[model samples]
Target: MNGKRGMHYVGWKTLCKTKASGGLNFHSAVSRSGPLKARLSWRFLQNKDSLLYQVISAKYGNNLWDATNRRGSSIVSKILLEGAQ
Candidate 1:
Protein backbone atom coordinates (compact mmCIF):
# COMPACT_ATOMS: atom_id res chain seq x y z
CA MET A 1 0.00 0.00 0.00
CA ASN A 2 0.91 3.72 -0.16
CA GLY A 3 2.59 3.15 -3.53
CA LYS A 4 4.99 0.66 -2.05
CA ARG A 5 5.41 -3.06 -2.66
CA GLY A 6 5.32 -5.30 0.39
CA MET A 7 8.47 -7.15 1.37
CA HIS A 8 8.55 -10.98 1.18
CA TYR A 9 10.54 -11.59 4.33
CA VAL A 10 8.65 -14.84 5.05
CA GLY A 11 6.14 -17.13 3.40
CA TRP A 12 2.44 -16.62 4.07
CA LYS A 13 1.98 -20.12 5.48
CA THR A 14 4.81 -19.51 7.90
CA LEU A 15 3.33 -16.17 8.95
CA CYS A 16 0.00 -17.89 9.60
CA LYS A 17 1.47 -20.13 12.26
CA THR A 18 0.58 -19.61 15.94
CA LYS A 19 2.14 -16.72 17.86
CA ALA A 20 3.65 -19.15 20.36
CA SER A 21 5.44 -20.74 17.41
CA GLY A 22 6.94 -17.32 16.52
CA GLY A 23 4.44 -16.32 13.82
CA LEU A 24 1.79 -13.61 13.49
CA ASN A 25 -1.05 -16.03 14.35
CA PHE A 26 -3.04 -15.13 11.24
CA HIS A 27 -5.40 -17.78 9.86
CA SER A 28 -5.09 -18.65 6.19
CA ALA A 29 -8.30 -18.95 4.14
CA VAL A 30 -6.91 -21.89 2.20
CA SER A 31 -6.13 -23.76 5.44
CA ARG A 32 -9.56 -22.92 6.87
CA SER A 33 -11.55 -24.22 3.88
CA GLY A 34 -10.71 -27.90 4.43
CA PRO A 35 -12.26 -28.12 7.88
CA LEU A 36 -15.24 -26.01 6.76
CA LYS A 37 -15.90 -28.29 3.79
CA ALA A 38 -15.46 -31.36 6.00
CA ARG A 39 -17.90 -29.97 8.54
CA LEU A 40 -20.45 -29.34 5.78
CA SER A 41 -19.95 -32.86 4.48
CA TRP A 42 -20.42 -34.27 7.99
CA ARG A 43 -23.59 -32.26 8.41
CA PHE A 44 -24.86 -33.59 5.09
CA LEU A 45 -24.22 -37.14 6.27
CA GLN A 46 -25.86 -36.59 9.66
CA ASN A 47 -28.91 -34.76 8.31
CA LYS A 48 -29.97 -36.77 5.30
CA ASP A 49 -33.55 -35.70 5.82
CA SER A 50 -32.70 -32.03 5.58
CA LEU A 51 -34.01 -30.13 2.56
CA LEU A 52 -30.54 -29.20 1.33
CA TYR A 53 -29.45 -32.83 1.47
CA GLN A 54 -32.62 -34.01 -0.23
CA VAL A 55 -32.26 -31.45 -3.02
CA ILE A 56 -28.62 -32.25 -3.60
CA SER A 57 -29.23 -36.00 -3.57
CA ALA A 58 -32.15 -35.70 -5.95
CA LYS A 59 -30.10 -33.66 -8.38
CA TYR A 60 -26.87 -35.67 -8.09
CA GLY A 61 -28.46 -39.10 -7.54
CA ASN A 62 -27.47 -41.73 -4.94
CA ASN A 63 -23.97 -41.91 -6.41
CA LEU A 64 -23.41 -38.51 -4.82
CA TRP A 65 -21.33 -40.13 -2.11
CA ASP A 66 -19.47 -42.37 -4.53
CA ALA A 67 -15.92 -41.00 -4.85
CA THR A 68 -15.17 -42.14 -8.40
CA ASN A 69 -18.30 -40.82 -10.15
CA ARG A 70 -17.93 -37.06 -10.00
CA ARG A 71 -18.69 -36.51 -13.65
CA GLY A 72 -20.71 -33.30 -13.86
CA SER A 73 -21.36 -32.36 -10.25
CA SER A 74 -22.06 -28.81 -8.99
CA ILE A 75 -19.45 -26.90 -6.99
CA VAL A 76 -21.22 -27.53 -3.67
CA SER A 77 -21.41 -31.27 -4.38
CA LYS A 78 -17.74 -31.39 -5.36
CA ILE A 79 -16.68 -29.61 -2.18
CA LEU A 80 -18.73 -31.94 0.05
CA LEU A 81 -17.55 -35.11 -1.65
CA GLU A 82 -13.94 -33.94 -1.68
CA GLY A 83 -14.03 -33.50 2.09
CA ALA A 84 -15.59 -36.95 2.45
CA GLN A 85 -12.74 -38.48 0.53
Candidate 2:
Protein backbone atom coordinates (compact mmCIF):
# COMPACT_ATOMS: atom_id res chain seq x y z
CA MET A 1 0.00 0.00 0.00
CA ASN A 2 1.18 3.55 -0.73
CA GLY A 3 0.09 4.72 2.75
CA LYS A 4 -1.18 7.97 1.35
CA ARG A 5 -3.71 9.72 3.58
CA GLY A 6 -6.99 10.81 2.15
CA MET A 7 -8.98 13.93 3.03
CA HIS A 8 -9.08 15.05 6.63
CA TYR A 9 -11.74 13.28 8.68
CA VAL A 10 -12.06 16.16 11.13
CA GLY A 11 -12.29 19.88 10.52
CA TRP A 12 -9.52 22.23 11.67
CA LYS A 13 -11.82 23.93 14.14
CA THR A 14 -12.71 20.60 15.74
CA LEU A 15 -9.05 19.59 15.92
CA CYS A 16 -8.06 22.83 17.58
CA LYS A 17 -10.60 22.56 20.38
CA THR A 18 -9.57 21.78 23.93
CA LYS A 19 -9.37 18.15 25.05
CA ALA A 20 -12.22 18.76 27.45
CA SER A 21 -14.37 19.47 24.42
CA GLY A 22 -13.39 16.09 22.86
CA GLY A 23 -10.47 17.26 20.72
CA LEU A 24 -6.73 17.60 21.15
CA ASN A 25 -5.78 20.46 23.46
CA PHE A 26 -4.15 22.76 20.98
CA HIS A 27 -4.04 26.50 21.47
CA SER A 28 -4.16 29.01 18.66
CA ALA A 29 -2.10 32.17 19.18
CA VAL A 30 -5.17 34.34 19.68
CA SER A 31 -6.70 31.90 22.15
CA ARG A 32 -3.47 31.57 24.15
CA SER A 33 -2.76 35.28 24.30
CA GLY A 34 -6.22 36.11 25.69
CA PRO A 35 -5.54 34.60 29.10
CA LEU A 36 -2.08 36.17 29.17
CA LYS A 37 -3.51 39.58 28.38
CA ALA A 38 -6.14 39.10 31.09
CA ARG A 39 -3.47 38.13 33.61
CA LEU A 40 -1.42 41.20 32.75
CA SER A 41 -4.48 43.37 33.15
CA TRP A 42 -5.28 41.80 36.51
CA ARG A 43 -1.71 42.34 37.67
CA PHE A 44 -1.70 45.93 36.53
CA LEU A 45 -4.94 46.55 38.39
CA GLN A 46 -4.00 44.78 41.61
CA ASN A 47 -0.34 45.69 41.96
CA LYS A 48 -0.12 49.41 41.58
CA ASP A 49 2.67 49.54 44.15
CA SER A 50 4.82 46.94 42.38
CA LEU A 51 7.96 48.01 40.57
CA LEU A 52 6.64 46.84 37.22
CA TYR A 53 3.49 48.88 37.68
CA GLN A 54 5.51 51.88 38.79
CA VAL A 55 7.80 51.65 35.76
CA ILE A 56 4.91 51.35 33.32
CA SER A 57 3.09 54.22 35.06
CA ALA A 58 6.19 56.38 34.97
CA LYS A 59 6.73 55.79 31.25
CA TYR A 60 3.05 56.01 30.27
CA GLY A 61 2.14 58.85 32.66
CA ASN A 62 -1.35 57.48 33.32
CA ASN A 63 -2.86 55.51 36.16
CA LEU A 64 -3.79 51.96 35.19
CA TRP A 65 -7.29 52.48 36.56
CA ASP A 66 -7.84 55.65 34.51
CA ALA A 67 -5.72 55.11 31.42
CA THR A 68 -8.39 55.76 28.84
CA ASN A 69 -7.75 58.40 26.12
CA ARG A 70 -4.19 59.05 27.21
CA ARG A 71 -1.96 60.85 24.67
CA GLY A 72 1.41 59.08 25.07
CA SER A 73 0.49 55.70 26.51
CA SER A 74 2.44 52.74 25.14
CA ILE A 75 0.79 50.15 22.93
CA VAL A 76 1.21 47.52 25.64
CA SER A 77 -0.53 49.77 28.12
CA LYS A 78 -3.42 50.34 25.75
CA ILE A 79 -3.85 46.65 25.04
CA LEU A 80 -3.79 45.74 28.72
CA LEU A 81 -6.28 48.45 29.51
CA GLU A 82 -8.63 47.24 26.81
CA GLY A 83 -8.31 43.69 28.11
CA ALA A 84 -9.12 44.94 31.59
CA GLN A 85 -12.32 46.42 30.30
Which candidate number has the best lDDT?
A: 1
lDDT of every model, 2 decimals? 0.84, 0.76
Q: Please give the range of 10 consecutive residues that has the lowest summed lDDT in model 2.
A: 60-69
TM-score of each: 0.64, 0.53
Model 1, runs deviating above 4 Å: 1-24, 67-71
TM for candidate 2 is: 0.53
- Judged by whole-model lDDT over C-alpha atoms, candidate 1 comes out at 0.84
Judge candidate 1 at residue 60 and give its lDDT.
70
For model 1, what is the alpha-carbon lDDT of residue 21? 90
Ten-residue stretch with the least lDDT total in model 1:
64-73
Expressed as tens digits, the lDDT of each residue in 1-85 for candidate 2 is: 4659666588767878898898887667777777788888888779889887888878766555566666776778777876776
lDDT of 1 by residue, 46-70 (tens): 9989998999888878777773465
